[model samples]
Target chain A: METILAQLLNGLDKGGAYALIALGLTLVFGTLGVVNFAHGALFMLGAFCAVAFRQFITYETVTLDPTKLSPWGAPLEIKTPMAQIWFGDFGAVLINWSVPISILLAIPVMLVIGIAMERGLIKHFYKRAHMDQILVTFGLAIVLQEVVKAIFGANPISQPMPVELRGSADIGAMLGLTPGMVTYPIWRLIYFLFSASIIGAVFAFLRLTTFGMVVRAGMADRETVGILGINIDRRFTIMFGLAAVVAGLAGVMYTPLVPPNYHLGMDFLVLSFVVVVVGGMGSLPGAVAAGFLLGILQSFASMTEIKAIIPGIDQIIIYLVAVVILLVRPRGLLGRRGVMET
Target chain B: MNIFYLPRRDAITLAVFALVVLTMPIWLVPFGAAYPGLMQKFAIFAIFAVGYNVLFGLTGYLSFGHAAFLGVGSYTAVWTFKLMTMNVIPAMIFAVIVSGLFALAIGFVSLRRSGIYFSILTLAFAQMCYNLAYSVLTPITNGETALQLTINDPRVLDLMFSERGAGLPSPSLLGQGMSGIEAFYVVAVVLLIAFYIAQKIFVSPFGMMLRAIKSNQTRMHYTGFNTRPYALTAFVISGMYAGLAGSLLAATDPLAGAERMQWTASGEVVLMTILGGVGTLIGPVIGAWLIKYFENIFSGFNDAMLHHTFSWLPQGAQDVVVAITSKFVGEGWQLSLGLIFVLVVVFLPGGVMEGIRRFSSIFRNRREPGPTGALKTSPAE
Candidate 1:
């Protein structure tokens, strides 16, 4: 029972990430009608935003300490982070909480990037073949990743979580299991909650707001919406920005879990794409459902008992699921009829 | 002539192409790219790209898993070398057959969907193959270290010929060692044959059917013609082409790595096809050569080489030039490649062929008297 619960928790944690990334992907696909291969780069860029923010806050101020003298130097130098020097305790708190603080920084940054990407490159590819869109966006992805690699070098940079959130939580005792049986990381749980809240917020915004209704209507039929004298293009562009923000925020929050790296975007991109396909193209709820389903399936596959039966099945379960889904149900789980069919 | 036959001009063009390929070693020397190994790779990858074009360029199905076939070919060739003989012929044949089978299986499943879904399915299958090769199939693939010839392998043909000696024997044809410049010729010949087959298919009814499928599959379906077989055949043919290329890669270098089957490798061929001009006979070959040249030659350019190349400049100017150019070479080759991909896709959708045509037309217009009149009158005429 404890193992099942542990696996469920693990699965949900991973599913949160998948859902976040796929949600963004489906949003862009639904709104723009162009498959953005560079969406992963946006996620990577978001993680870097957090990294940059952390670096900015930790910039040091060097000063000479006359009272202390070095053995071979005139005087000892004291180095303090500019944040601490400028704001004292609050600055220390800020530095410790850079991950959450990065959410603020990533929103505006990712929005601009998303809008600029749409306006500059993807705009022209809207009318082109799917192959052209894929090629161009893939090219853009390579450029973004290479530029990131150039700046950060080709190494994973670990981001420190806050001191309060560093340890694992004992859920076993609370759940009436053995005391030490179900300890899960506190941050992962927090990430799950954060992602759920974000997903909920997005859904609520879409459900309750007039702007979202218009956007939803536009997604269903752009021509009809446009014929009704609505500037759906601008809303769609904003929708693109919102998707970027979601992906960016996901990336920002994810840094503490998996160290940020130049290739993180690409790694996540493929999996998220799989998720989107399995969920059914252009179906937002489908993306979320498939994300969780695949995530749980993956977690279950990783169990030792499962591995013993089908060796290396864990590594390929998602792809196998994708193939099976594609074969059995061509339109995907929640896909509309004839979405990409000829 | 029949509608499916090559035009007279196309026949001459093929001959010229054959001549250029045959004499590549001699002509490439002036450009410092005459090394036999690189030249061999040029031919092998050109075959791969041309085969890839048969599906992607002729038909608009953008397969993202062709590298899986290539990997299959390499593995088969290496195994043939290990178990049977160091003969290139058997290895090539085995590789092609094995890859063709694998392609048939993968294509049968993936061809069920069209467009992005098809791409995803292919990618899924390739990634599955790659993942399996990396983990469970490691015993067959030799895991991450790459599969290479070992001393204890049973070489039936080698033992029959009494050719056992110190170190591993090189793959040979008719008792002649197929390495160095000899291997280049072998690859070049095979490339010509591959190109010939591709040309024949391009001008054949099957090729027209593929083009028709690319333009509108629904119409083809409604016309009472089953489109699945045509697509499946193209997929298998292209897969065999990739397999042949992979076999040649092993036949030349004699090692096979799982990385060869990676999606990035698949993406490289796609880039080559598009960059050179998709659907054109010579475009993919040019794209392959251009990419291979950049990968091998441009990446070899270092700070020292840059400094030496710009030695005629003043000291400060030389440093500045080297600093700027160094980033786009060596470790930065991928960046430049990305930029080129973007620029090409954006401006020259027809790729290098389109650029060449536009350039030639500009020169033709300039050379003729009354250029505007000539341009207007020529189209009407």
Candidate 2:
């Protein structure tokens, strides 16, 4: 029971990430009707945004201190972060909370990026074949990754979590069970809640608002929505920006768990594409459900006892599920008929 | 117009192409890439790209997992070397058959879906193969360090030929050791044969069916023609081509690494095909050669080399040029490749072949008297 609970927690935490990335992917696919292979690059760019913010806020000034001489008899240089000099204790606190603070930086940055990407390159490919879209976007993805690599180098850069949430929380004890039985990371719990809220916010935006209704209508039938005299293209472009922001936020929050690297986008891109496929293309709710399902399935597959029977199943569980889901339900779990059927 | 008949113009082009390929070691020296190993890779990857074009160019099925077949071929060839003689022939044959079977299984399942779904399925299957090769099937794959020749392996035919205590023998054709230039020639000959087969397929009725499938699958289906078998056959044949390339890689290098099965490698073939011009016989080969050249020669350029090349310029100008051009070469080759890919896809949908045709047609038009004469010399011709 303890093991199951722990795995479930792990699965949910992972599922939150998968769900967030897949949601953005599905949104772009649903609205633009172009398979954005660069979606993962956006996620990666978000993580880098966090890293950049942290670096920017913590910019240091070096001064020579005569009292602290080095072994070579030269004056030792004392470096003080510029934020600390400017804001004192608040600077330290801000640095500690940089991951959360990065959301502000990421939103505008990602929106501009998403809009530029849509208007500049993907706009031309709207009438082209899906293969062409995929290839061009893939090229764009490679360029984005390489640009990141050029700036930050190829190594994974770790982003620190807030000091208060450094350790695991005893969920089992809180729930009146054994104290250490279901201890989970506080940050992970926070991430899950955050993802849930984002998902909810997106849903509410689409369901309740008139703008979102029109967007939804556009997703169903672009020509019909256009016939209704709605500038669905502009709305769709904004939705693309929204999708980028979502992916960016997911990446910003995820940096504390997995270190940001140049290749992180490509890695997640493949899995997220699988998630989108398993959930059915252009199906938002299906993407979220499939993400969690695959995450949990992958978590379960990774258990030692299970892996003992089916060696390497953990590595391939997501892809295996995708294959199975695709074979069994070609339209996916909640996919509407005729969506990407041709 | 006969399918089997070689048109006089095409025959001349083929002869010229063959001559260029055969004399690559000599001609490529001026480009600072005369090394036999590099020349062999050019031929090998050209075969791989040509094979990929059969499915992607003809049928418009963007398979993102073809590298799995390549890996299968390489592993099979290596295993053949381990168990049997160090003869390239039997190893190549075994590699093709094994990879062909693997392709058949993967293609059968993946072909059930079309468009993005088909691509995702193929990608998933390839990733599964990669994970299996990397971890679960490490015993077969020899994991991480790459599968290479072992000293204690059972070489039944090898034992029959040479004495028991000789060092690991190089892959040979009959009795002649295929090393250095000989290996390049061997690969070049096989490449020519592969190109010949691809050309035949391109002109064949089967190729037309594939093109039809690409243009409109629904129309073909409604007309009583089964498209599934045609797609599967194309997939298998291409898989065999990839397999042959893989075996040739092993035959030249005598090692098989799991990295060969990576999706990025599969993507590389796709890039090669698209960069050259899809659905055109010569485009893929040109793209393959260009890519391989960029990877090998262009990537070797560094700041020092750049500075040396541009020494006549002022120091400030040299520095500026070096700084700018440096990003497109060396470790930054992929960035340049990405930019080129985007630019090509955006501007020239038909690839470099289209660019050449357009350029030549512009000259042809200028040479002609008026609009009527220009019209007489159609662009297609």
Candidate 3:
């Protein structure tokens, strides 16, 4: 029973990440009909943003002291608040808190990147066939991955969690169950809450706002939306940026969990795509449900008992789920008619 | 003689082309660097590309999962080798039949959708296959490590034991797999001829119907022609060709891995089809050669090689030049490929074949007087 609960939590966290990325992809695809293959790259860029911000906050210039015994010592230093809290033991207060500071820094940077990508590359591809658009975006994704690799090098960067959220919380103890085996990471819980809030906010914005209505209208019928005296193109472009922001923010929060790498995008891209497909293509709610569902399935598939029967079932669970879902419902779980039909 | 009147010109060009291909390995014998193994790789990929062209180029159906068929073919051939005698012919035949069956099942469902959805469905299926082969079907696929014969395993047809040794001898016709430049040359020549025959099929009446279906399926449906069978036939035929290529791959390498069915591998064939010029006979072959060239030769370059070659230049100049050129080769080859895709889609939609045709047309136009006079004074006329 405890094992099952633990697996369920794991599933939720994994599903949260999947939903975030798939939500972003579906948003762009839904609003613009442009299959943004670079959506994964955008998420990758967000994690890189965190890495860059972390580097900046902790940056120190060393000067060679020829006149003194100590060589390669920094003459002056500045420290961040969290840095002091975390690295007070080493007497390096300022830069020690880089990870927490990176969150604030990731948002604006990711937003700007989202806007730039939408305006610069994706804008040109909106009018082409979905395949052509997919090709271009896929190309853009390769370019982005290569560029990131060139800048960061082909290595996974380690990120220490915030000092406050460093340890595991004994949920089993709280429940008065066994003393161990059900400890959950505080950071993971925080990540799930953060994702849920973002998802809720996005849904609210789309449901209650006028801009959301216009975007929904655009998604329904671009020709009719245009005929109604609205520049649906500009709106769609903004939606693309909005989608990128969601994916980027997901990456930012996710960095602490997985520690981002250049090729990480490709690793998640396939699974996220399956999530999108299984969720009923353009349906936002469906994407979330599918993400969590597949995540749980994946968790269950990784059980020792399951592995004994069928090795590598965990790796193939989501794909098999996607194939089954697609065969049964060609339009997907919540997919409307005429979406993927011939 | 007028160019339009010279249908025989194509035949002559084909014969010359066949001669040149057949003679290439012999010519390369003096160089010794261009081995038969490399030539065989080129032929195998070319065959795969040609099969891809059947569904994509002729029928306007861009399948993003053709590599799955290739994988199926390879696995089937390897299993056949394990079960039956090490006859290359039978393996190739089994590959085709098995791959055809697989395609029939996949195509029946996937073909329900068209355009981007169709591409995605195929891609999704391929990814599923890749994942399954890597994990769930590890007993059959042999997992990340390729399947190989064990000493205890029975050879069903041969009634002989593979000598209990550290490593088993390669399964091939007579004894060992094809060796030296001569074997590769033979394979390449055979494939080239087969490609030519396939090309003839592309221009045949049946090929024309496939083209018609591509242009307007609904019209054909209304006209009482069962378009489904035609499409299915094309899919099966292409799958068979892919299987043949896969069997050849197994024949040469003697192992099948899940990586062969990757989405990127499927995408590579699509890139080849588009790059070479879709619907044209020679395009896929040319595209295959170009991509394989990039994959092998271009990616082989490293920073050390670059530094050594440009040592005489000033450090900054060398760095700048190397940085720019490296995208075309080395680790950044995919970037170059992506750029090529963008440029091709945006500008030369007809691909490399179209460019070659245009270049040839200019020369032909210069030599001929005018269309009216040229036709009136045709050699036949």
Candidate 4:
């Protein structure tokens, strides 16, 4: 029971990430009818946002301390973090919280990127074949990752969680079970809660807001929405920005779980794409549900009990599920009729 | 195979292609690719790209898992080498049969859907194969260490024919050993045969059916033509082509690894096909050669070479020149590839073939000075 509960927690945080990335992908597909392969690059950029922010806060100034000579007889150099010099203890706090705080930087930066991508490159491809769209965006993704590689090198850069939230929490004790029985990292739990809110916020925005209704209508019938004189193009572009922001935020939160590497986007993008297909192409709710479903199934498959029966089940369960779902349920779990099938 | 009554233009094109391929070791010297290893790769991957183009260009089915078939072929060939003989003939035939079966099963399932779903399904299936080969099937695949030729126990055919040799035997054609330029010639001959077969398919009525399916599957369905079988056949054929390519890889270098089945390899074929003109006969081959050349030769260019090339410039100017050009070559070549791929897709959607066509059309128009002559004989001609 403890093991099962712990795995469920593990699944939830992973599912949160899958759900977040898939959400953005589905949104872009829904609104633009364009498959954005560069979405994973956006996620990687978000993680880099955290990395960049940390570097900014940890920027140090050095001064030679002539009074304090080292054993080697050279004057000692004192290096102080720029944040510390500017804000004292607050600067130290800023560095500690840089990962979470990077969200502020990621949003606008990712939005501009998303909008620019849509306007500059993707706009030209809208009339082209889906393969062309995929190819061009694939090229864009390579360029983006390569650019990151050039800047940060190919190695993964780890992001540090805040000092307070770094340790695992004994959730089982709080839930009235044995203490420390179902321990999970504090940040993971926070990430799950954070993603849940983001998903909710997106849902509410689309369900309740006037602008979102228009976007939804645009998704349903682009020609009809355009005929309605709403200038749905502008709103759809913003939705693309929203999708980028969502993917970025997911990356921002996920950096501590896995270090950000140049190829992180490609790896995650492929899985998220599988997640999208399993959920049904362009189906928002289906993306979320499938994300969690695959995540949990994957978690369960990785269990020693499961592994004993079927070796390497965990390595391929997600892909296997995707294949079966794609074959058995062509439109996916909640997919509407004739969406991307033709 | 029925290309015996080849069209006038196609025959000439094939003749030229054959001449170019046969004399590659000599002609490619100027490009610094004259050496046998890179030349062999050029022929091998040209076969891969050409085979890939049959299904992708003709049927418009973008299979993302074609490398799985290639991997199956490689493994089958290597297993043949382990169990039967070091002869490439049996290996090639066995590899084709196994990978064709593999493709049949996968294509049967994946062809149920079209568009993005098809791509995703193929990708998923390939990833599954990679995962299985990497872990669960490690006994057969040798996992991460990879499967290579050995001289331990069985070489049933070679043993039947002759006594055991002192060292491990290399892959051979008949009684003679194949390596270096000889191996390249063998690959080149196979590529020529594959190219001829691809051209035959392109002109065949079956090819017309596949093209019709690509253009309008719905209309074909409405006309009561079940297009799935045609698509499946193309898929299987391409799978066989990929398998052949894989066996050739094993023949050239007796090793099979799970990395061969990875989707990135599959992506590389797609890039090759697209980088050349899609749907064009020689486009994919050119694309394959260009990409392999870039990957092998261009990537070998380092800052030292760049500095030497720019030795005439002043010190500061040379440094700046080298710095700028260095990113587009060597380890940073992928950056250039990505940028170039993007530019090509955006501007020259038809690929290098289209660019070539457009460039020639300018001269043709300048000579003829009218649209009538250009229209009758395709600017492509």
Query: Which candidate achieves the best TM-score against the true structure?
Result: 2
Report per-prediction Cα RMSD to one decimal: 4.4, 3.7, 6.5, 3.5
Better of 1 and 3 by DockQ: 1
True contacts kept of 3: 0.45
lDDT of each residue in B90-163, candidate 3, tens digit only: 88889989999999988887776766667777887788888889877888999899876665455566655544
Candidate 2 per-residue C-alpha lDDT over A85-161 given as tens digits, one digit per residue, 9 for 90 to 100: 89999989999899999999999999999999998989998877777789899999999999998788899999999
Candidate 3 residue-wise lDDT at B17: 65
User: Where does candidate 4 clash, by residue pair?
Assistant: none
Worst 10 residues of 3 chain B by lDDT: B372-381
Worst lDDT run of 10 residues, candidate 4 chain B, spans: B372-381
* Candidate 4 error regions (>4 Å): A60-79, B1-3, B311-317, B366-381
Give DockQ: model 4: 0.52
DockQ, computed on Cα atoms, for candidate 1: 0.46
Candidate 1, clashing residue pairs? none
Off by over 4 Å in 3: A1-3, A56-100, A172-181, A223-229, A305-313, B1-16, B26-33, B149-167, B174-177, B307-315, B358-381
> Which regions of candidate 1 deviate over 4 angstroms?
A60-79, B1-7, B304-325, B366-381
Q: Give each prediction's DockQ, rounded to 2 decimals.
A: 0.46, 0.53, 0.31, 0.52
**On TM-score, who's better, 3 or 4?**
4
Flag clash pairs in model 3: A79-A94, A80-A94, A82-A97, A83-A96, A83-A97, A84-A93
Off by over 4 Å in 2: A70-74, B1-9, B366-381
Model 1 agreement with the true structure over B1-381: per-residue lDDT tens digits: 664467787787789999999999899988889999899989999999999999888778889889999999999999999999999999999999999999999999988888888888898899889999999899999989999999888988779868578887888887789999999999999998899889999888899998888877878888998998999999999999999999999999999999999888898999999899888889999999999999998889899999999999999999999998887888878889999999998988778887887788788886543222100110000
**What would the per-residue lDDT of candidate 3 be over residues A1-342, giving only the tens digit for each residue?**
898888888788888989999999899889877777788888898888888877765655444445555334644333343434455555253344556566677777777887788887777766655666766677677778877877787899977767778888888888888988799998888888878888898898889999999998888888999998999888887887888878888888888899899988877887898898888888999888888888878998898988889877787778777777777787788877867645
Least well predicted 10-residue stretch by lDDT in candidate 1 chain A: A333-342
What tens digits encode model 4's per-residue C-alpha lDDT throughout B162-273?
A: 9988898999998677799999999999999999999889888999998888777888888999999999999999999999999999999999999999988888898888
